[model samples]
Target chain A: MEEESQIPKGRYAADISSINEAHARIKSLILKTPVLSSTSLNAISGRQLYFKCESFQKGGAFKFRGACNAVFSLNDEDASKGVITHSSGNHAAALALAAKLRGIPAYIVIPKNAPTCKIENVKRYGGQVIWSEANMRSREETANKVWQETGAIFIHPYNDGRILSGQGTISLELLEQAPQLDTLVVPISGGGLISGVALAAKSINPAIRILAAEPKGADDAAQFKAAGRIITLPETNTIADGLRAFLGDFTWPVVRDLVDDIITVEDSEIVKAMQLCYEILKIVVEPSGAIGLAAVLSESFQKNPAWKDCKHIGIVVSGGNVDMAVLWDSLNK
Target chain B: MEEESQIPKGRYAADISSINEAHARIKSLILKTPVLSSTSLNAISGRQLYFKCESFQKGGAFKFRGACNAVFSLNDEDASKGVITHSSGNHAAALALAAKLRGIPAYIVIPKNAPTCKIENVKRYGGQVIWSEANMRSREETANKVWQETGAIFIHPYNDGRILSGQGTISLELLEQAPQLDTLVVPISGGGLISGVALAAKSINPAIRILAAEPKGADDAAQFKAAGRIITLPETNTIADGLRAFLGDFTWPVVRDLVDDIITVEDSEIVKAMQLCYEILKIVVEPSGAIGLAAVLSESFQKNPAWKDCKHIGIVVSGGNVDMAVLWDSLNK
Candidate 1:
């Protein structure tokens, strides 16, 4: 665990006002994804569970909401040169599509090891791809080099204020659909999704518990929160590629302060949740998107006192862009 | 070919008016399922196509629309005693749920060989199940016995006018959503769905070409249309379990008169279409549900002069409640 004093000052500074403004700005541009009741999950947990299906969102993920908000929020002068971002998959495809909609060029720095399907998705959406080595340093260096050369603004995948504010729209929509939610369980990677959701949800009803569901293999958020400071994992590994990020500087403090708990679930739990979603719900949820349900189904959550009497629970199903081959392998395992 | 003079009277008597009334009666009960465009299929076919996703409907098939309509069309006295139907799968589950919603008891007659998953679905939705031999005679006899014992109204799976009307709702919704649709392709089983869809679509716009898609293995509808009479095969054999039915008395005439052509797709084509739906559309579709798409994608339709200049095409994707084990094996094949 890292020291508490190492925490950043501005990370937890976001409030409801900014999130509301973000909602207003991006509401027209993004899809108001449906919030569906999970009868099976609810029955199993003995709790009324509502899933905010961001998996059905444009670009097949919640990242589009943030990417769109960020790209559109930029001023005319800043937008002309376009935006640059580094992502292994979802974020790059999302940012590319969002930028294209705004008639702006997008420079996406992708790792060489990125999935072929994701790479094809990025290219299909008209994003310029700049391939880089599969390492944080190489990705950062490539993004910076592109930004410096082309005067394009660097859109950090999770650390950006605009991105967080955009992602907050999901909570706003969820609360609107299911106003009686007692708790919100969100999967945390760089904490962008949870930070935005927590800020918006907590601001609306501070009593609503905000919990983070993390993969046990990628438990940076859990470690960071326990240490009361940001703690970057030296290496990350998980089937849930979307939730394998080391906690971002801007997101760690927000997650540390606002999120009530960080629950970790095994990769197998995620696989099981994915199977359930596919078989019972008839919805294609990627492994990362199933993390919240996995966490709830995990023994840890069943034993947690906070979940004992929760009347209404809201879970964000973040994305559904999964490779069929990988999914088949995971299910067989 | 069978002689035209030998055709059954009921098979030649159906028209568009009955289908219209059915659509109006059941409009409130059934969902206007979304029509989604598949970028992958469009690229492959070089023809702009839209999939009417009945797979997302209640009970996981368009069968629910017909089932609900048929159940609710019952008189107050008949409804009070409850309803009974014989189906190996989708229809049983659909009728069970629809009857449950209307506060009526539902009796399902299933073959002992029916998939366990489907049997559980009927029970899950509050239907009493009665097992019968895996043959049409046993199923009908069991249903009749249940009706006789309980005074329950018998809702024929596909033979009744009310059921046909209910299935016609899909065409009504599809035409309303895509007004420019030049051609409509629908799968044929006992011909209830196609008969209804043809009536609704042709009535609304006589210029629109209506086609029936059938599996080659269970090409009873195709044979009937070709013969200008109803024809029952010696034995039914097909992977498209839903399409393995002889045209019913009420449905035969509606399809024979209204449907311009009956296109037969191979079982392999249906499997491939199902796989494409799962992989590209991110929706689970049973082999039978994909027959319409298979017809459009197969060599028969692709090389047809009628399809050469077609701008808009609509294919009814009937259901998604597939046995995952069967799907896994089929996918491997």
Candidate 2:
């Protein structure tokens, strides 16, 4: 870990140098996920769309990149206590797998209503799951209790400087993979992914533009951006269960100032994008993962003349931890 | 086209040299599909598995490789007449896309019962679809009539030397991607893919083993191998719609002499493999595409003591052109 004096002074913990450090630190630990493109999709979107397939990342999401970096960044003495996180999604599985690889224990506080597939992933990665009520307060409280009892380090899913720095490594590889990309359209939830990606991409090429895609049902990012302040939603509802969370403090500043736009898409549009991903791209992407494509294909983005310069666009497919049983049920109906 | 005298004298038209030529010819036209590996899958199979993701290939299948090669291999005069093929599968769409790219018309003879998704694919790629009775005899007759009327050259899906040679390019890339692979488990339909892969892989590494994976309902290849002769099934029924066709004369000799073994898997096993592909690899693979993985995970392969030396294995995920509507209907039931 870097000394406290050396830590970058910013609204967020991560800076370009720290992200670069995270990239170097986790280079061998994570997969250099491929950037895929479809000619048909490109033709339809009228833009050269490149997909950074984080769906193929370890633990089936880009979360592994951040989790691995955070786990490895810990000092030998600090790491002995293991790690803890409150997540019912990709982050839980990612941290578990990362800790397992580092030969450290991971205590995961998962909601009782969490998908079975996610629970299976955590168990498969040797995570000790502590069940919690399907509410943020209960989940966080349980995580706090576990942290105090086990002396385990609390690893925030997206609100940590180290975690965001690790996630930023995606742009390091993405730009190297396709440097011609003038714009990056990323799905935003807790804003960690977009924050990291924007910081790294802008640091490398200040001319590059970043657009945050959000589901209309959970359009807190768009609301926050419009209001110029954090706007917490009373409730959230969207098929993209992963994107229901609002922006965290560590992620908000980066998303607010650095990210150029927040494009909200309807659930129907997201479903269409998911279908296109299945039929054309031949990749299984959860609803949240498909939002970037949905945002680009949405009428607002296509009709907006201000963003016509985005010829070469990079869309980050954030994750692929979809519950097929639930998806089939919904599709069947 | 190569002179008749220059063509190799063998049961099949393609040889190591022709396959090499095909690779060179299609190098710029086709995609260099990626080889992906899952650590969890490798752990489960107890072997280092490298997946040649031809699902990511153009036309969502490996057929594009051969189709592109065959279209480009034509002389200017012959190419002027355009190309024709009798099929309602990946070949029709692949040929259509290849022809479109080559600035030629593709006349595709499709059975009326063909899936709507396939028909849409042909139309999307500008292939002129000539509907035929849902039988081989009627389809072939219709194709012959169209050939005579339009003066178009017939491009066999897998039986032709050029098509097989084009398919052989997969092994060239696969071997280059993973040279340590001691064995290749390839899904067999008309034996075109495995024949081409076998010829190319064995030519490069004489000791490399080739295993042909077949659906149990369409186990003509397995029966033929056991009988030491061609054994055509009067009727074939398989969830793997692509693997229902038996071996062609052009592909039979190669399968008989070059392929080391044929492993037949049940539909249930293939479905399980497909689920694993969606849930774990996050890739959409049709039943035929998942057969290679199913063969690897089958009881026969797992329990067999004779094949213990196989460590590094390459599984060719053949295609990803599934009809989601039909899939959902079946899964719902």
**Top-scoring candidate (DockQ):** 2
Candidate 1 on A67-162: residue-level lDDT in tens? 998998899999999989999978899999889999999999999998776787789889999999998899999999999899998888898888
Tell me how far the alpha carbon of residue A10 in candidate 2 is from the true structure, in angstroms, after superposition.
Answer: 3.3
lDDT of 2 by residue, B155-184 (tens): 999999999999999999999999999999
* DockQ score of each predicted structure, in the order shown: 0.22, 0.49
Off by over 4 Å in 2: A1-11, A326-333, B1-11, B326-333
TM-score of each: 0.83, 0.95
Please state the i-RMS of candidate 2.
Answer: 5.5
lDDT of 1 at B285: 76
- The most accurate candidate by lDDT is 2
Q: What is the TM-score of chain A alone in each candidate?
A: 0.93, 0.95
Candidate 1, B96: how far from true, in Å? 2.8
Candidate 2 chain B: minimum summed lDDT over ten consecutive residues — where?
B1-10
Which residue pairs clash in candidate 2?
none
